[model samples]
Target: MRIGELARLTAVSERSLRYYEEQGLLASTRTPGGHREYPPASVDRVIRIQELFAAGLNSATIAELLPCMRDVDGGPGENATPWLEQELVAQRDKLDRAIGDLERSRQVLDEVIKAATGR
Candidate 1:
């Protein structure tokens, strides 16, 4: 499949595919006419990549953790704790903090509204 086709199928932007290639997260071959050709496996790879990115893992960490992502039992390596798991935990914590901040801001806004309305 071509890069555009993969992008369409995976719902990821073409620019992201190119960036992934540049970052070595993805590999592709060039046709004689200079078009990029992707193997079918790339579709699955892209899904996994996007899922990890959504979990708040950076590209560098994803690169290092890609091997573990493949292993069903979290691989045998020491670093195979599944960075995605740790990332998800961190993201949850960050989200909790954000929610608290938002709630505080909302309370302030409510007070301002009540004061302005003399309620």
Candidate 2:
């Protein structure tokens, strides 16, 4: 698919897709006319990339961590266990902090609404 179609499929902007390419998070093949052509699996990859970014993993870390997401049997490589476990733990901690922040923000909004409505 083309970049536009990939963006739509991935629910990401075209600019983001291009930026992902620039960040080395995504790869595409150029057509004879210089247009980028992405495989269908790029959609899933884009979604995964967005999730990783949302979890507070930077691009470089994501690039390293993506390869670690294989089956338990390690079809990709056996050496990814230690690094993958550490990275995943770090990502989880970051996500927990974000969730706590969001909960606090929600509570504040709830207080504001209750005050405004005299509840």
lDDT of 2 by residue, 1-119 (tens): 99999988878999999999998888999999999999887887898888888877889988888766653233454346787888799879878988999999999999999999999
RMSD of each: 3.8, 4.4
Q: List the residue pairs that clash in candidate 2.
A: none
The Cα local distance difference test for each model comes to 0.83, 0.84
Q: Which candidate number has the best TM-score?
A: 2
Q: Write the per-residue lDDT of candidate 1 for residues 1-115, one digit (tens) a residue.
A: 9999999999999999999998888999999999999999788889889988897768997786675565333335445565656765776798788899999999999999999
Error of 2 at 116 (Å): 21
TM-score per prediction, in order, is: 0.68, 0.69
Candidate 1 Cα misplacement greater than 4 A, ranges: 53-65, 70-79, 82-84
Clashes of each: 0, 0
Q: Model 1, 101: alpha-carbon shift in Å?
A: 1.3
